[model samples]
Target: MSFKYMPVLRSRENEKRAFKNFFDNKIFSSNTIIPLIEIIQYSPNRKNTTDSKLPEEIFEESYVNEFKNYDFPIIVDIPMYIDLNSNIKQKYKDFLSEMLSNSNKKTPSKRLIYFNKLSKLKNIIPVVSYNPNAPYPLKTISTQEKYLRTNFNKIAFRVFVNINTITHILNEVEQSITSEDILILDLQDDDYKETKFNTLFQKIEDIKTSKKCKTIILNTPITEDIIKKNKNVQNDCPINAIDNSIVFSYKSFGFDAFGDYAGIKKYLGPDNNGNNYNPPVTYNIFYAYHQNKYIKFKSQTINASKPVVAPSITKSKCWNMYGHTHHKNCPGCIEINNKSIDTSKPGNWGTWQAINIQHYIYTMNDFL
Candidate 1:
């Protein structure tokens, strides 16, 4: 298939209250944007693979329900399966069957169970993964496809194309047992940022053209400099066709730029050189979209009862350091390290502006 959906990666729990505000408003609006929400589960170790859980367990039913409340589709990602040992292979099969099996009655077959799950949960999608590094038999992927397509009239499988094993893209197409709804090119670019933009883009194009499935590249979109000049102004800032590329990063999932990585921990200080070595925090901000929903939080610092508290100054604006800026030694960042970055209230000046900077580069004339 050519492609039909825009992808949105899922965000962490604490930051979700912010995005829910947007979904609630859409209940009445006519315009629509349905982004793919991904929930990727991580593996703890190289061996002992039987421990893998369903995507529901890792993402959690409570959090998944929050996303479910919205009208968008959910892509549940479990660990890559082909390379798993026999124990894990059988365990995963059973787990999939049980989760998708009919709730009120018994399923006639394994295929029927998955079909029922897909039917019952109209918005939920399953993802099968391939790891080229360990290099598992392609037959595993082909077999799973057959099982799924047995009963469902139309089904889409989201495959995580790990960047480490880029070679599998070509084979992924030829070996596919049935047509796919969408293929996710999961890029692990945390350490590989400088890989030429065109190089990756070309491979993606080739894969999409060769396969019957709609392909989506998942490398982290380069964060645009929002604190600087307007990216929309042409001439001065040339348009990066790459920014509009048919690519979505983890941030697209509409999760928090903060809290995703930090979890319960707060930001600590920097190293001797003043560089940010703060390991307890991670921020994910999406590019090319304007305006978003943020959670209303109250700080416990001001009073065991009072509200209002807060970040730093940049370019004459009280930028929310926790949402956008991660630079240590700054006023807001210092507060976080000193346990003083206690921000209260949603749409609070700092976070509301800092969360996701969705500025489009095209001029109004382009749309006209």
Candidate 2:
């Protein structure tokens, strides 16, 4: 609700662990950070039939109960890759309505004013996807519009559009959107160009001026290609410094906030259908976030002739040289610094991810 930073997090154990740990440690204020929780699409392994679970099932088992633990407002979205099932859509809306009603009942007299003020912003915001190129576009838009009109006080509609297609997409969906709804412009892995950005900013301003949408968010990704390219140049442990130049550039336009895929790349993996994927021999790569940059601690590669025995981020030269000074002394950094956790175990991959996400959220809150 009126957040400065929206970190797009997938509905995975790692992200959940990070959010809970961040909240428990009081690392950042809830007021400034509103996590956009994307329900990850289910990808089944061909060898394991039981591994497959429907998106709706995942929501009920993993997220429905977890919503009570978070005090801050969260934006729930179904990833664009997933087929928008009507059953799941209605279920999510029902869950949000129930949560809002429960929150209203729990508000104390002393906090009533504050509660009312925040309630106006809506405690649970649902995201509707609008992509004209998608299959059955009219049906998709109509279903989402009906869902939004049913119970949600305010909604956020997500669309992947660049300067070239922004006008067309806006015109197509203008009737479905409202002034109160939030417009999320997802620039997935698009490199920033000054002329394009200038035009895009003007388009956003035009949307607001025309009352097409009042709140707009600019979302982009730090692609895997960027990280890999930087790593190849450095060879050793590379410190990748990415600035928020694009995010800050939109400040003058009165955009609501900036969003990103946290520190992880956007998921473009296998579809919902099962695949014959096999596990590969690879070492864990530790990550640390500090000062708007990600420091990657690369261990021995699978094909390396000689193996390095560094098991955690603390063992890396970068950690010893600058991590202690550059990183925040939060729970994640403390866990890595203490040298107690193993970063190699399958479950512990989540720990490593949690570490970076924890730091990313902390850094973004301060930066924003």
Candidate 3:
């Protein structure tokens, strides 16, 4: 049986239309824009999962891309708002300023209007541009019908349940456990630490049995203490050491890539040809190729951080993907050994991204 209140996926056409409407409405608004921004700034901050914090303006950037990338179009059932102080209002103004400056590349007038709308939002959570506002956000549903219709290739939706509500969802997901694998990133402890060895191993076993998740990616720092603790575990999850030479190799370029093979010493550079062999960094593009998903478990970088579920990979070939700086040089993508090749483009290089839970389940269901 399906959950009653869970939001259903919408048709791709409808999603596109709704998103267009959302943006279009903002562009047309005058008196409404500043209040909207106030609402967003005043709203309680959402939690982020990565330890590396980005400027608040990044969310504004995300708003622009969400339209470009998402097919299903995520919407909250209510108009969520935030309450902001003078400091936050100024920060948001700066973000709006940057976005407005860049608007000339696309629809300049339209973007400006949208920014104006953002400025108008007052005392609201700033649910993705069009998400419905509610007195309390609970049991929100994301419809993906539109994404499927667009042939948008890879599309996934993540519902950001408050930390307080996550345990409930986890319980629901666990109880509904079918053949679909349910992986959990228990952020309570470091993956490579001995102090948490018994705890980690026990959780792993529990997931293997009850949760039945196929792959479980643990998050933990490779601190000296944690490393010392893991000395006894003959086998451990691929540890992407921060100072590894291979990590340094690719990082010197750009593109933050990270993955299991990233820490492999064999891939390290200074070849006989005097070329630098950099390990891959993790990005959304890589995850798409691998068909994976990423979940933020512990984001220590940002104040008022919340874990978010997003693609470990992206379809865009333009920019190399990077996540929070959990471990420096955690290569998510690998470069082919060729002096003449441009590694950033899609076809020439290889990388890894995370597998979304929804898509993973859908795939498993098909396989069965």
Q: State every prediction's TM-score relative to the real structure.
A: 0.45, 0.68, 0.23
User: How big is the positional error of residue 34 in model 3, measured in Å on the Cα after superposition?
Assistant: 44
Cα shift from native, residue 116, model 1 (Å) = 7.1
Q: Summarize candidate 1's per-residue lDDT along 32-95 as a digit string, tens digits.
A: 2234433222211113346567643433444444544656554444333223333223433344
Which residue pairs of candidate 2 clash? none
Q: Which stretches of model 3 miss by more than 4 angstroms?
A: 1-170, 186-191, 219-337, 340-368
lDDT per residue (tens digit) for residues 150-186 in model 2: 6667667776655555666666556667776777777
Ordering by TM-score? 2, 1, 3
Model 1, runs deviating above 4 Å: 1-12, 27-68, 79-119, 131-133, 151-165, 175-180, 190-207, 210-212, 221-368
lDDT of each: 0.35, 0.54, 0.26
RMSD of each: 12.9, 9.4, 19.6
